[model samples]
Target: MSPVLQIALALGSVVGLMGFMAGVRHLAGTWQIGSEVQRKLVHIGTGIYALTLPWLFPDRWPVYLLVGLTLIVMLLLRLPNSRLGATLHSVERQSYGDFLLAISVGVCLFLAGDQLYLYVLPIAVLTLADAAAALAGSTYGTKFFRVEEGEKSLEGSAVFFTVTLLISVICLMLMTSFAPPNIIVLSLMVAGFGTLVEAASWRGFDNLFLPVGLLIFLSAHGTSTLGELVFLAAIFALSIVAFKIVAPKFGLNAHAVRVYVTSIFLLLAVTDPQNTIFPILVLVAHIWRRSVAPCDSKFPDLDVVAALVLVSLGFLTLGKATGPTAISFYGIAAMGMLMGFCAIAASASRPVVRYPMVLALALALFAIREGVVRLNPDSANWNGPMWPAVFICVALTALGPMILSRVFATHRVVKLTFLALLIPLPYYVISTGF
Candidate 1:
């Protein structure tokens, strides 16, 4: 048999396994609780498949076949009848729309020919950062850190940043063979950015933005030289300390701005040709923070400090290995701020009416942005077919949220939306062509 054929068979097996796990989770009542056990099982299973499939089947055909099968399974899962077949499918009907959105973004990134580290970073941010925040907020969050209309706690953000940092470092080590000396700094910076963006405005779309943002940084700088990298690390560390010291007197928003400014200067100094992205990101963040207007209450500032620390670390790590471009960095920063604002708005809204409208608006924005990018040949990647795939994704993303909101008004559609977002993730894994 041809190598491609063998590879195709292996991928088929992976798809089958994913389907089986999804079905089993649906059967176990634990899916409703957002059960960690179930989530871990699915993640572990998917990870194993991702790691072993290529070696098991050494050809492109198997990969393609696996992709086809995975899509089929996802489509089937979307069907009401299919869901019912899996343990009567009694999951809550929340705005699972975010999940679907996340999956779509992940697939788009993968198809864009992003690196392995780039591919895994966002997923790690979503899974680890989000989980840490929730767990810590619920368990250790004594004082609420209210920023504008958001409900994030200082403790929660701290946990989120810490977990995201660790996870990024681990992912970098395991996923990529290339480990520059300044990796520690790079991972910290990327994770910090990922967490801050996520904390400030994810609207649940962190899954999409975090990894893409990190990849932008990676693409810009390939990797830094040893001596220069060390200096960059020292600067980043000092910036974090300074931000922490002045945050209380200036306020969270002010602190965020200061950190933003410092990051820009550091990037300019370290990278050869200044990447415009960091400055643009700082500008956008400043604008967004101003737009939100600071809340009247005094909240604990630990989370803000932690987020700054982690982001600084991530940047340092990435800066050592590669330089970043202005366009990509700022674009990601803008998107992150937008997501954070949306998330806060959604949380503040009365789920019945306001949430749906927000979701619609987000979908619309995503569509318009995607459409503009697709139409403008100059804005897109010259080598790959990013436009068409992004166009399709935009349509599907818009349609899913709209339909769910309209039809499942009483049911919590958030979870379903989230699941739908994840639909494209498997395709990304297969298409990675690893």
Candidate 2:
């Protein structure tokens, strides 16, 4: 077959499937089906199609071509003149969730190479788990917590975690050579991360946060013994049960307790048992100080727990990264904490980074102190190359965004998140002299 013809044929098939979904959406709406119900159908159908990407295209270029084209089309569909624009675009205003969703698939394709599981894991979870969470929540949701304008329920989150857990396990087992125990831990960790990212995400930004994050962090860390794996799984299960048992007392957001336990389990998986205290201690303080039920207020402080998850991830990353690479982890971790502050500050409709800069500086200082204590406590190597640069970069990156956020004035969380991810690239480049 001619290469051009094959490419044309492949692209047509993708567009055709999308057209079919659009037709279904329209027909369903005309038949008096709810818009939200039709939306979920499109969501699941699109997701099921996404799973076929690794198999549908023989190479990465085709994946890129299809995804890029889809993204452009989706963007155009949001314009005022488009036929279905009114139905497709949310009535509220401009929503970038669909845009981010396509971009995430492109990113997973670009970076995944032969690691199909890595690409598939995030997409599948977002598709199935997220859809399930939404469907179950909307239908059965009773106890409420706030996200943009809607309230997410405990029941829906449980559905998300269950589905995500199943998907993660299947992805790991099918794609990797890992044993049962490692698969269990890895799946639990990935599911936990997805839940938090999904919970914290607003305006469909979870698409970006969940997949991009898993792409970076969700590798199968091997477990040495079945006994150790069993013990690890036991702790994870107990933590969930404990939270469910106790969360009612505080009207806690399930996302918080869910992510906190995941952090501890992941930290235990990656880091030495000794260094676990810093992250755990921080979690304890967060929980201990919450005297009121999280749901007492019309709005809950979602950022604090979500930000800690990112920081905990940074700490865990350090255990895996080495030498020059390890040095980059500090800056990444600092930004993780800073990103948290930005999330919180954005919720209050404030110019967050202006004040988040203080948190950034404090975290930088803590990083420095931890570095001093951990690396060279015997000697006063206060003049190290990495810590100094990390401090400067952390401050500059955290505050620099304040100006940009002020100017942009909307979607600061999304903007700050990408900025935070970018801040570490230079450190990696400089470290490798790339």
Candidate 3:
């Protein structure tokens, strides 16, 4: 089919799906079905439709166009007065899952290209595994554990793992030529990784992370030995324990720690382990400084953990896509810059020393990055733009707090998150120079 015709069909199908889900939502209310179930119905339906992309539309542009249109419609539906908001927003939780879901579809499609299974597997995990976990948690959840700002059940997580494992097995079996033993090991790894991501995720961000993280993990580790898989899993387990034990000292909450540890582990998966050091140090420094700053009753301090996850994932994608050692440096620098901003924001009361502290922290992070590279025998050659990138990141980061403070003194999470989205702009410019 022609691209134009494909785009037209996609739009029609998406619109029809939206109308169908709206009707479903109405019937759900009539039947006294809970809002969460209603929302999951839409999620599952959307994800299942997404799975057909490789066959339905052969070209990437059509999928991109569909994603763009869907996002705009989803945003409009989110408005308080929109009648269709109930189809998705019926849950009381503050979530941007719908928005992220649209973006995840577009991103995974763009990345996967002709790799049908690559696209299918991640979307399957996101859709089926996530819905299963939520439903299981809400319905059969007996044993609960605290996560971020809420509680998740052990029962729910187990269900999630089971569902993910099954999905991974089926996908690998049909999609690739790997032996049964390797398939089982890869399936186990995928399930474990997906379950951790789902459990750690809050407010629908899992819609983005589950698919994106799984795609990256599978792409990087599809040929791994059982021993290698076990070793990585052991390190991941240790990281979680370490984060849980140390988060309190750094003034990081359970949620922040979850985001940080998961993101770092993802970084570790694709990049040299040494490349992750500065980012880890930045995570520690950012949270520790925020912890020490005076508390305010009127406005709660901003939680930059989600922002950290966003920035890290952005750079990871950049590094992976471009295949440049300098890209890794940029990731470290971007994170270091974020650490600087956290310092300035945490010291909002003491404005006098904020800039100096930010400068010092940025320099310290640069020094640490250099030190790590020097110590690693296997370090890739340093790029020329790296130091300049670090300087530019720090300068831009310092300006961010000032700009936000001028508009509003209180640090709202959304405001900082939007700011974090801009953190990569400098590196994008610098990479052009390189």
Candidate 4:
């Protein structure tokens, strides 16, 4: 089909899907159905429709156009006067799920070009598994646990895992060339991590994290043997167990620990295991600060995890684009140093004390990173930052807490600007050796 015709059909199909969702919402409202049910209905419908993208557009521009228009519509739905908001916004918790859903579709489609299974599998889980978890939780959930935003039930998480495992198996069998052993290992891996991510995520972020994380994991480890995959899984499990044991000693909340652990495992799956050490140290420092002087802040832990993940993914992308250099790892380590500074800055009331402590921590972490590199020279080789470069990165990261305290000090939802500001520093430092 011609590009113009393809774009036309895509837009029409999206409009039709919206009309169907609106009709469903109207009927549900007439019947006094719960808002959550109405939202999930729309969610499922959107995901199912998204699955048809490979067939609809021969090029990605059509998908981008569709995503942009749909995102505008979703944002419009958030307006107080808009009737559509009633269905999607009925939940009490704060959420940007609708926005994330639209963005994930476009991004995932782009990443999976000419690879239908890569695209379909993640979307299917996003659709079927997520809806199943929500419904199962509401209907059958009994045991509840606290998270950053709200409480999730064990029953729901279990349902999510089961469904995700099934989806993984089915998608792999039909879509890939993996053997039975590989399929089993891969399905288990996705299911375990997906459940953790969903349980830990708040504010509709699972919509974004689920598909993107899946794509990264599949792309990175798709060709590994069963033993290799199992070894990776074992490392993830052991790390989680270790964190769970130590987190309480540091006075970190269960929710915060889960976010930290899940993000680390996601990193481990997507990149080298050693690459996880930097973020792990940054988190430990944050928790240690919390342990020393606990502050009562309502800012969600998931937001912190989201910020870290976003920054790391940026460096990781740069690594791929630049090709075959350990520049990405260096960039991430630099980010880790910046975050380490921010984490300490959050606790240190005096600049004199904070700066020294941050400097020491950064040097120590860098030393450790060097030791690891020396042990596994083939894994990565990159020069350590000079004293001036270290100071510059620290100086840049110091602005994070200051700006955050001035602008968002009182807000309930923490802005991502602190870490987002640190993004360019790593790239600039590593790319130019400045």
The model with the greatest TM-score is 3
Residue 143 displacement in candidate 2 (angstroms): 5.1
**How good is model 4 by TM-score?**
0.84
Per-residue CA lDDT of model 3 for 193-239, tens digit only, reads: 88888888877889988998998888788778778877877888898
Question: Which ranges in model 1 have alpha carbons more than 4 Å from their true place?
Answer: 1-18, 21-27, 30-48, 51-140, 143-150, 167-181, 201-203, 226-434
Instruction: Please write out the lDDT profile of model 2 over residues 91-195, one tens digit for every residue.
Output: 353356677777778776665667778788888988999989988988998876766565578788889999999998988888888888678877776777677
TM-score against native, each model: 0.46, 0.63, 0.86, 0.84
lDDT of 4 by residue, 1-434 (tens): 79879789778976886797789788996998898999999999889989988876777788888998888878777887877677889899988899999888877787676677778989999999999999999999999998765898999999999999999999999999899999999999999988888887888988988888888778778789988999989988898789889878766677777788878767766656666666666565555544553444665355456766766665554454455354434444445444543544454567667656656655665576565555544534444434445444545455555445554343312342344334444655565453
In model 4, the clashing pairs are none
lDDT of 1 by residue, 230-285 (tens): 56557756866776776555445543544354445434543433233323432443
Candidate 3 stretches with Cα past 4 Å from truth are 251-255, 294-302, 316-329, 332-336, 339-342, 345-360, 369-383, 399-409, 412-434
Lowest lDDT sum, 10 consecutive residues, model 4, at 408-417
